[model samples]
Target: MHATPAPPALDLPAIQALAAADMAAVDALIRRRLASDVVLVNQVAEHLVAAGGKRLRPMLLLLAARALGHRGPDAHQLAAVVEFIHTATLLHDDVVDESDLRRGRKTANALFGNAASVLVGDFLYSRSFQLMVELDRLPVMRILADTTNAIAEGEVLQLLHVRNPDTDEPAYLKVIERKTAVLFAAATRLGALLAGAGEATQQRLHDYGLALGYAFQIADDVLDYSADEAALGKHLGDDLAEGKATLPLIHAMLHSDAATRDRLRAIVEAGEVEAMPEVLAAIEATGGLAYSRRRADDYADAAERALDGLDDNNAVAALRGLARYAVRRDR
Candidate 1:
């Protein structure tokens, strides 16, 4: 029998190590800002923040800032702001999705009550704005404002597509780009801005973040079906249960034969996965997983290319590695 080669190692740990100090600074700042006079606000916000996450978005900002030669308090401030915005979204998403679990733990809405979760999410949004104003840069405020607005718009768009069997691949891609990629783009662009990087460098980093965000979200969608709940940190088939016709499902539907397509359409329109075996089988028969993986790879390649001709350094190398890790990791 022929020998099989092992896959290359993931660079996430190395990237985390490289950015450790700054990430710690960001974490400390997040903790300080999360405090509230109201007990409920404090309890709800702190609960979610205490639940550990990879902090990837904030790390992206810190890394991009350092890569562009910025070492200052402002980057830490903005990184905290980014995290608050992200956490706020999670609180709201759980309430909207009626999700019970996240990160293999009960969701804020489940544990804290839906009203409390929604109110705390609003608190985070307002708190993020307060932090943004402290930065005293109008452009920074502008970018964050626009990015947050776009994310809200994306949420609405996603709601429109729920249980929508007709949702096409382009519509789905647009949702991911707006909901996820824009924030990543804002994070990197903020980094370049903080470093006083020129327009061209900022554009390159922005493109890198945008493409990376697409890759990351697509891979996440794929994992909804393929990953173990423990590894994925969320309920398996949560997307399907929510009637989200993500890339894999969309691709499978497109490639399936008439009978398979009808079965999928009925399942999707009803937003039930009682026939999960049939759905998985159809996806496999149609090569949906392979197609989604290939599409993710293409975006990862674009992200890597976006860094072309930038200054060569550990930060730059980490950014390159991050693009690959976004797609290759199981969780």
Candidate 2:
């Protein structure tokens, strides 16, 4: 008897190819909706959209919608809305972090000035709300409203933890849930809602998005220390310079000797860029990076498991591929 054929490998290109047409539509919608009468707002918003990253969040919404057999224009509109919300967060985050660089280029706050960036971020947030209101779906409006509020709370929570070396893993996870995972969960859950999916299916997709968000952010924190500056598309040690005690640093502190722990804590409190070499050595010696990678992989696995009972389709396969990519990507 012939052996059972293996399932096809769904690499990044394959996944992107599968979602290309839908993404193109989403992009078009985004551009049209981003237009404003104010030129500065237009310039800043255009600059941000042009310096594009992977567009993963919107793609997640699109893929989830397609997975549930949704082919309507509502998916496109909602995807654009998700992109606007995410873009707004980035603008605000750069200002809050005092970051000069993102995606290997000057941040909007750096180029357009902080006030412009902040105001334009508000524009995007308000624009996104407008788009959602146009949808006239109460559930969609409610989910996004709650998600944005949680994100704001997360910013405050992270601000509190900044420069506090005592910030532990649980505290960090709470920040990640609000700042990153809530939006992700909103995207997928909205897709399911638009598709008229059952409540159980919606919850599973929400679980998938949340796990993927955790995996993505944890891996990003790892990359901030381990990846080359070009590959990472931002300054190495930015997190250190921001005084944010991410998982690696927390793990290193937990596992290291008293003297080393004290040194790490002191460096974090000071936001000392000059102490990076010492910090790297401590992280390596304590297996901090490895431990963090293991945690990211666990979350990725959880993301995949959340899709266990879903229909086997290209979109579902792409979702699985994204979970794998979330942990494996360099940037």
Candidate 3:
């Protein structure tokens, strides 16, 4: 791989404006749905929400909606819905992965314990469905319900893949499509649907979101080995340490010598990366990071291609910029 110029940042102010508007609406919805005499519910919900996050889902929804000429308030409500789905997933993810750290901080499961986190996650999931009913849009409900199920299936598949170093790219891609791309597909597809766009336009947005998600998750996997721990806000090589068979390991195995391949395989199968430095070295020696980045690049390009039928707009331009950044980010 050759050195490439960095992708430009989105006018964060623009994204923030999008975030703030969405958050205001989302907050209102959250408050209304969460309003309860149960003190524990509000406390747990607040803890999870206040935990730092990029609000990427809502931002994507806003950008997609704007790209398709949404001038009304539907985007805000929908944006909140997107966030609720994402947050609930995180809550459940921490529980399932038994993760101690996220975004360089203790996860809700770590802080609140698995039971609270899982229950809160359940609350958020049910709350999102309640909000969907308020929208009175059965189609949106179907999309979200289907997306959530796919995500759940993805998580289970990933659980199955752990400690199995032979997990191939095809298997991994299926997990990504479910765990990551489904929500992305839902977010953008909802934007198109809410805007009353043509079916072709709706599908284009859906494909774009799916590809973008693939790029995003692949980049994140690459960063675990390539990025500084400080920059990542978590320990580097966590996935390898956890025995997850991400793209880097899969690609490395494809090209490594027998001894190197065994070493890599052993590390994951052992589920304790005491030899992480050696494993990272082996992966780097075999061009695994480069291979992963290239695959991520292909997904990013696919996302760009999906926009071929959409009318040009700032939101579309920003999304293109974001797709570029997704694969390019160092952390």
List CA RMSD, all candidates. 4.5, 1.8, 4.2
Can you write out model 1's per-residue Cα lDDT over 272-326, one digit (the tens) per residue? 8677788889889888888999999999999888888777678888888899899
Global lDDT of model 3: 0.82
The best candidate in terms of lDDT: 2
Model 1 residue runs over 4 Å out of place are 1-10
Per-candidate clashes, comma-separated:
0, 0, 0
lDDT of 2 by residue, 9-94 (tens): 37899999999999999998888999999999999978988898899999999899888999668999999999999999999999
Off-target runs (Cα >4 Å) in candidate 2 are 1-9
Give residue 212's error in model 3 in angstroms: 0.2
Candidate 3 TM-score, true structure as reference: 0.92
Sorted on TM-score, best first, the list reads 2, 1, 3
Tell me the TM-score of model 1.
0.96
In model 2, what is the error at residue 120, expressed in angstroms?
Answer: 0.2
- List the candidates' TM-scores in order: 0.96, 0.97, 0.92
Q: What's model 2's TM-score?
A: 0.97
* TM-score-superior candidate, 1 or 3: 1
- The Cα RMSD in angstroms, rounded to one decimal, for candidate 3 relative to the true structure is 4.2
Q: Which residue pairs come into collision in candidate 1?
A: none
